[model samples]
Structures are given as C-alpha cells and as structure tokens.
Target: MQRYPMTPAGHLALEEELKHLKTVERPRITQAIAEAREHGDLKENAEYHAAREQQGLSEARIRDIEAKLGGAQVIDVATLPKDGRVVFGVTVVIENIDTEEQQRYTIVGEDEADFKINKISINSPIARGLIGKSEGDEAKIQTPRGEVEYEIVEVIYGE
Candidate 1:
C-alpha cells in the first residue's frame, strides 16, 4: 500500500471527520430513512429515495476517510529538526523574485491543502520546487501564469 505523508493535525482532522460521520451523520440518515419508510408506498416515496442516496454518499465518504486514515503516516513538525531546508510539513516563506512579494505556505498532504489558508499540497508544483531546498535557495516553478521564480526566505518547522 502507498503510504500517505501527512502532518499530525491532518491525521487528527481526518479522524475527527470520520467520527462525525459515524456518530452524527450515520444516525441522522438512518433516522431519516426510518421516518421515510413509515410514510408507506416505498415505490413513490421520494423522501425515502433521497435519504437512501444521502446515506450512500455519506457511507462512501466514511469509507474514503477510513482508507485515508489507514494509509496516513503522520509526521509531527515539532519533532523535525529546525534545519533551514524545506521538507514535508514545513512552513516555507518565499519571496517572489520578480514581483518582490512574500508569501507563506505550509506544505501538507493532499487532503489537508487549503489555498485560502496557505496550506499547499506536497505534490503541488510550487511545493515540489521548494522541497529539499534550503533557505535563500531560488526555486523556479511552473504555474498557470507561467514560470515564476521565488527565493526561500525561511523554513519553519512548526505552526
């Protein structure tokens, strides 16, 4: 099985979601299905069909989360050496070589990436270019806007 590299928080988030799905969503869907079933005429029961579809989707998500959790290899950033090199679970501060703009990005697992929060996937083009690079190293990454060069300003081990 391919192991998924994730931060400790990412693993915990997935576990929390799975718990919510099992404890909250599953029971709610089951209750909805039961209530719909009581309405009779199963063939014409739209509520029953909707509830069943929702149940299927919820179950599928639950299985996906479980599989992801099983494959997860959680890495604690705090345990890593605070070397200047960028690696998985490190927050890298980069300065745009051309635009002179600075941005902070935390490299994380695919499921934990949220651009709005500056959490980028390890597989992302920018992260790929930044990985294994030390502070002050220049990385040229290909993006939708074209090739952009950035200078690594700092590599942070933890949040």
Candidate 2:
C-alpha cells in the first residue's frame, strides 16, 4: 500500500480516535447488542436490528481508521529547517491578487483537511501550487470559479 503523509498532530488525532472507537464505542455497541438480543424474537426485533447496524458501522469505521494509521507516515514540522518555503505541514499565509484577501492555510493530509480550520490537503490545487514555493512567490491556481492568483507572504511551522 502507498504510504500517506501526515503531520504529527494529525497522526495523534487519528490515534486518539482509534482508541476511542476501540475502547469506548466498541464496548458500548457490544453491550447494546447484548441488551437488544435479550428482548427476544430476533426476526421482528427492530431494536436488535438497529444495534447490529450500529455495530457494523462502528466496526467499519475502526477498520478504516486502522488502515489509515497503518499507511500513515508522520512528519514533524517542528524539526524541519527554516527554509522560508511552503512545504507539507507548514502554514502558509497568502494574499489574493485580485480581491486582495489574506488567508492562512496549513498544508496537511487529505484525511485531515478541514476548510473551516484553514487546513488544506497537500494534494489540493491550492497547496499543489504553493508547494516548494518561497515567500514573495506568486502562485496561479485553477479552480471551478476560474483561475486565481495568490502571493505567498509567510510560512510558519510548529504550534
């Protein structure tokens, strides 16, 4: 399987989620299933069916998380040299050339991408355009809304 890049923080988050699913959620679902089965008449039991469905979903999620963790290659941005260039796990500040809007985004793994948090996937178009670029460099990205230009203003790593 191809290894996926992930920030150290992202890897920790995934590990925490996996632990919760395994230790808490899994036991809760198992208890629910046992209680539902005690209701009797499994053929027409809605509660039992629902519990089983929930168990299936929980198990599937656990498997998915495990797979992601197994394929993850955690990168600690803090240890990286201060190159003043945009790289994976680095937070980049940019200015839109047209609207003159300023924004910050942390380039992260796909699974950790959250637009609301200003954390973008490294594979995303904007991150792709900014990768390996230094501050003061201009990047042109193609979006569904059309082509847009942005000038890199800063690159920050750690906390």
Best by lDDT: 1
What does candidate 2's lDDT look like per residue over 7-39, in tens digits?
987899999999999999999999998998899
CA lDDT of every candidate? 0.95, 0.93
Residues 21-113, candidate 1, lDDT per residue (tens digit)?
999999999999999999999899999999999999999999898888888899888988888999999999999999999999999999999
Please give the distance, in angstroms, between residue 88's alpha carbon in candidate 1 and its true position after superposition: 0.8
The list of candidate 1 runs beyond 4 A from truth reads none
Give the clash count for each candidate: 0, 0
Model 1, residue 143: C-alpha shift (Å): 0.5
